[model samples]
Target: MNYEFTTVGALIGLAVAIILIIKKLQPAYSLILGALIGGIIGSGSLVTTVNTMVSGGEGMISSVLRIMTSGILAGTLIKTGAAEKIAEVIVEKLGEKRALAAISLATMIICAVGVFIDISVITVAPIALAIGKKSGYHKEALLLAMIGGGKAGNIISPNPNTIAVSEAFKVDLTSLMMKNFIPAICAVVVTILLSTMLSKKQGVQVTENDLEQKEDKNLPSFIQAVAGPVVVVILLALRPVASIVIDPLIALPVGGVVCALACGQIKNIREYAEFGLGKVVGVSVLLIGTGTIAGIIKASALQYDVVHILKMANMPAFLLAPIAGILMAGATASTTAGATIGAQTFAGTLIKSGVSALSAGAMVHAGATVIDSLPHGSFFHATGGAAGLEIKERMKLIPYEMCVGLTSTVVAVMTYVI
Candidate 1:
C-alpha cells in the first residue's frame, strides 16, 4: 500500500486534536485553535491557510452568536420558572402510579415543540432528579427514561432534523414522517414501559416529601407555578396546528412573551423583549460554532474524501445510508443531522445502490440516537453533570441507549421491510 498524506487524513488528525483540546482547553479558545490547525493541515501551505483560518474563525463567531442567543433564551426560560411550570403541570395530571407515563409524555410533548435537545434536557432534568430523590428511584434510570422520550421527539417530529433530511434527500416531510412515525412512536412506548418496569423492579418511587413542598410557607400556588411558561410553550408549539396563517417560530417567542406579560412575570414590555433576546444568546453562540465547524470541514473537502473512501468499498447504498447517519451522528452529536442531512445526503444513494428504503430509514434513526448516547456528546455531559453522575458512571447509560437504538432500528426495518 502506498503511504499517502491525504487531505482526509489531515482533517481526521485535526478532529482528534480538537477533541483533545475540547477536553483540556477552554471551549472558545480550543475551537479557534482547532480551526487554525485544520486550515494549515488541510491546505498544506502556511500563508494561504492562515487566511482561510481567519475567515473560518470569523464565521465561527457568527455561528456562535446564533447558538448563544438560543441558549440564553433557554436559560432565561428556566430561570423565570416558565419551563418548570410546564413540567409540573404536565406531571400533576399523570398521577403518581403512572409516573413513567407522565415523564414520557412530558418529554415527548416538550420535544415536539422543536426546542433544542440540550435545552429540553436542562428543562426536564431537575424535575426528574427531584422525582428520583423523592421516590428513592435510581437517578440514572429516571434520567434515561426522560432522555428516551426526548430522543423519540427529536427523531420523529417535524423539527430541524426532519426538515434537514427533507432538504438533503429532496423528499417530502409528510411522506417520510408517515414512513417513520410508527416505529418512532412505538419506540417511545416500548422504552418507557420497559424503563418503568425496571424502575419498579428496582423499587423506585418518589416519596411524599420529594413530590411535595416541605414547609408550604410562601409557596407559589400550583396555578401560579405553571400558568406562564406552560401557556407560552404550548401556544408556540401549537401555532402550526392552531392556525393556517402564522409562522411557528414567530408564534413560539410571541406566545412566550405574551404569557410572560399576562402572568405578571414581566415588569414591562422592555423586560419581556430583553428576556426573549437574552434567551437566544448562549444557544446562538453554540449554533454558530457548530455551523462554522461544518463549514470549515466542507470548505476543506472532507465530504468528498469520505465519498472517495466509500467509492472504494463494496458497500451497498442501504448500509451506506445507515453508516453515514451513524458517522454524522457521532461527529455532530446530533440525531437531527443524521435524519435530515445525513439521510438526505446518503439515503437516496443507498436506495439507488440497492438498499431497502425502510432499512435505510431505520438505520438513519438508529444512528442518530446512538451517537447521542456517547460520553462525548454535550447532551450526555450536561445531563450527567446535572444529575451528579461521574464520567465513569455515565458510561453505564451507553449500553442501554445503544441497545435501545439498535433494537429500535431493527424493529423499524422489520416493520417496514418484512
Candidate 2:
C-alpha cells in the first residue's frame, strides 16, 4: 500500500476552483480553469491539457445530452400548465390535511420519473408555488418540500444517477433494484417527516406574488395531464426488468410529445422545447467542466493516490463507501461523479475487505446523494431559476438534505444487517 498525498498541484487547483466558486464565478469557468491548472502541473504541456479536456468534455456531454430530452419534457409540463394542474390535484387530494405530506408526496413522485433534479425543480416549482398560494403554508416550506422530495428520489431512483451507478457496478439491474427499492421507500417517508420538523423550526421568507395570480394558460384536464409524466416515470422504473427495458432517452421525448399535443401546447411546442433547452444550458456547461476535472484527476496520479488511501484507512467496511462518496460528490458538485468515480477508485480495497459488490454499490448510492446540490450543482441553479430564488436565498434547504443523506447511509448499513 503506497500511501502518498495527491500532487500539490492537484490540491492547489481544487482550492482555486472552490475559491472562485465562493466568489460567485461561473462553475463552468471555475472547473475548466481548475482542470487546466491541474493538467499543467501533471502533464506540463498546454497542448496535452487541451487535448485531454476536449476528449473528456466530448465523453461527458454524450451522456448529458442523451438525458437532456427529459429536460424538454419537464419544461413543457411547466409552460403548458400541466405541472400546475398536477400539483393542484395532489394538493386537492390532501385537502389542507397534512399539507407537508401532500407537497412531499407530489415532489417524490414527479421527480422519480428519471429526470434530473434541476429539471424536476424547473418543471414542478410553478405548481408548488400555486399549491403554496392556495394554502396558508409558508411558501418557503412548500418550496423546500418540492426540493426535498425530488432529492429523495434523486438519491435512489429511476433517475440517471441510478442508471449511472448500475452501469458502473456491473450488477444485474434487477438485483441492485431489489437491494435498494425498499430502503428508498423508507427514505421518502423519513424525508417527509424531517421536512415537517425543520419547517416548523425555521421562519423562512418567500416572494410569492406570482404564485398567487391565476394562471390563464390553456390546460388539460387533471387526469390527462397526469398521464404524461406518470408514463415517463413508469417507463423508467421498468428499466431493470429483464423482460422489458424502457429507455428513458426514448420515453421522455415520446411522453413529452404526447403531453404537448394533448394539453393544447402544440401551438407553442417549439417555444416550450426552446425553454427547456435553455434551462439545461447551465447544467450542460457544468457537466462539461466536471468532465474536464474528472479527466484531469484521472490523468494524473490522483487515482492511484485515492485508492492507496482507501486501502490503508482505518474505517469500517460499511462506512467507507458513503464517506468516500460524500466527499467526492461534494467536491465535484455531481452525484454521478461521486458515486461512479469514488466506487471504482475504491473497488479493490472494498472487495478485499469482504464487502459484496451489491452492498458497496448501495452504500455508494447513499453516500453520493447527500451533498449533491452545492451552489455549483445543476439542481441548485435550476431550482433557483424556477423558484425565483437565489443560491444564498434557499440555503436553508441544504441542512435537511445533509440529514437525509446521512439516513441513506443507515439504509445501506441495514441492507448489510438484514
Top-scoring candidate (TM-score) = 2
What are the Cα lDDT values of the candidates? 0.55, 0.66
lDDT of 2 by residue, 144-259 (tens): 77777776667544454555455545554435545766666676677778767766664444445656465476667887677677676566556665447766567776777777
- The C-alpha stretches of model 1 lying farther than 4 A from their native spots are 1-7, 27-32, 43-80, 133-136, 156-183, 200-249, 266-280, 300-302, 308-314, 318-322, 331-366, 405-418
Indicate the residue-level lDDT of 383 in model 1. Answer: 69
TM-score of 2: 0.80
Estimate the overall C-alpha local distance difference test score of candidate 2: 0.66
Best by lDDT: 2
User: Residue 240 in candidate 1 has what lDDT?
Assistant: 42
lDDT of 1 by residue, 1-418 (tens): 1112335634664475458534755433444455556655564465655554455445444323333333323433444555556666677787665666677667765665445555676677667767667556676677667777777666654445544454345444434444565666766786676677667554334444434343433323445544444554454334345643333344345544544554465554455456546645533443333333343454555545565677779533345555666665665555653344355445545666676664565567655776655655466788676556678766766776665565556555666456
Error of 1 at 15 (Å): 2.9
